[model samples]
Target: MATVRLLTMLPLWWSLCVSSALTPVRLRTLPLWWSLYISNALTPQALLAEWQAARIKSLDVDASRYHAQVLFVDDDNARARMAESCADALAHWADAGWWIYPHSCSLTEDQALIENPRQEAILTSLGFDGTRVTAAGAALAKEDLDAYDLVICADAAVRDAVLALGEESYETSVRLLADFATVADARSRALFDGLDVALAERARSRQDGGELVVEGADAQSDRDGFDALLESTLVLTAALVVFLKDSFDASFTDSFNGLLRTHFYDERHVDARWADAEPALRRHIVTGALDPRERERLFDAHMTGLRQRLSGDGVSS
Candidate 1:
């Protein structure tokens, strides 16, 4: 009696499996059957082409709605936080002009916010809502790369980390934030030039060969060195913001590609390429203790100077 019952249930199970495989709606819910069906129905090449088409369509829709969607990645949360604060400072542009959405993440596995007392104090003084700034604990997901119009890395190492997680196709979208500094603009060029000199001097002192090496606070382990690093990151964040605003203003009607160009530092020459500039640049940055109004005033003054220089109207000292 038990054997007969088992035979009867086997036929029913077989029928159900066949039915599930043939039903389109059921296939959508069943991963195993869906994979088999897709494998039998389409070639791998054809499937990839379909996926590419869908991605392009989604990006087109996103572009139509916003001027640009950007993702900023860094080793620590400081750069990410600074990027958010800088974006807030430029919020007025979102009214009728370009709408920029900035997202941030760290390369570390732990998502817990790292403590940066100085950076936190500076941002707090700037009048930005602290609640709005939070960094992701882990690196960005590979599949989520398509969501951003651009993935701007804080430096070459950050860029490399991002690229390693993403496909080769994502290379075009990933770029060094420093690359957008607009070297043609005098103010921006001066900032980067000072950084290069500082980094070069430090690099030369440590090595005998005429090879250029770049070291950070990790190498010097001094309070002033660390402060210089923080100040440089802040300045770069501001400079990139200025560059982005100018790009959008000049190409208000252009496509995302038209508004931005693809630029990266050569792999062999990546050392100290985006490291912080000298402390002199910090004069333009608001960091020390100050009232909110004063902080805002100083921030505005720095941005105004950057804008003027980029626009061909030299800023008067």
Candidate 2:
């Protein structure tokens, strides 16, 4: 009887599976309030792809509306590489069911794309079309300027150029990408570093000019679950230390202070999955505080598992 019931449902299950496989995943077209504008040099395709995938997966939302525009300041040889990287990365993500829309613009109308014959040839050999891969040396149209919720300059020069564009109001949102890209060579870290900035800002906005209040712990505690909660808290603390230190240049003391400040600590606003564990987690994080050297050691010990949990695939583009 069990076998007969299973056989009866087999065809229906197969049909449902086929329908799901054939359906296309639709992504958003407009910019979300959490958009990030990046400088041209930092627009590496692999890095952007990893960031895009991680952000959407971890947050459980379609982050397709977040715009990443590349603004070029000079015709430096390196700009060619940036152009190609951004184009390829955006193209790949678009194909992967992301509504990615990347635009490239120049600081000045007189300047065209970077002119490096050797680099152009190399880029072409690497499957980049010379014509399509070049940065467009044109002023940003009004629509482009309005698309992003925040603008991130990769360096001082990019910041200066953006200021010269006469978007004074947007200046409040302009931040140096370096401030977010603290990790020396890890692009995925840089990406999440930026997300930390965006999320913090978003949380602050929800306060309406006041600090968010965290509710007190419940009266009764689960003694049986205490051991499991403690273990999870330690792991999370280590992962956060790694993120802040490697990606934001935060010192041990500053990292702990910032972690405590994040809205995620607020029991009232935190996700339901973390509600019961937050108070214990906070206590554990505080108790395990260490110096920079010890912090690095803890990070190294748990970095692999942390990334796997936060990013699903551990930062692979």
For each candidate in the order shown, give its overall lDDT on alpha carbons: 0.47, 0.35
Residue-level lDDT of model 2, residues 161-188, one tens digit each, is 6766756665554443323212212322
Candidate 1: where is the Cα deviation over 4 Å?
1-64, 91-98, 111-113, 134-138, 183-223, 250-317
Pairs that collide, model 1: 111-137
- Model 2: worst 10 consecutive residues (lDDT sum): 1-10
Error of 1 at 42 (Å): 52
Best by TM-score: 1
Q: How many residue pairs clash in each candidate at the backbone level? A: 1, 0
Measured by lDDT, the strongest candidate is 1
**How many clashes does the backbone of model 1 have?**
1
Q: For residues 143-235, could you state the per-residue lDDT of candidate 1 as single tens digits? A: 657878778776666777788888567877776554432222343323332233454243223222221111234313354554444444434
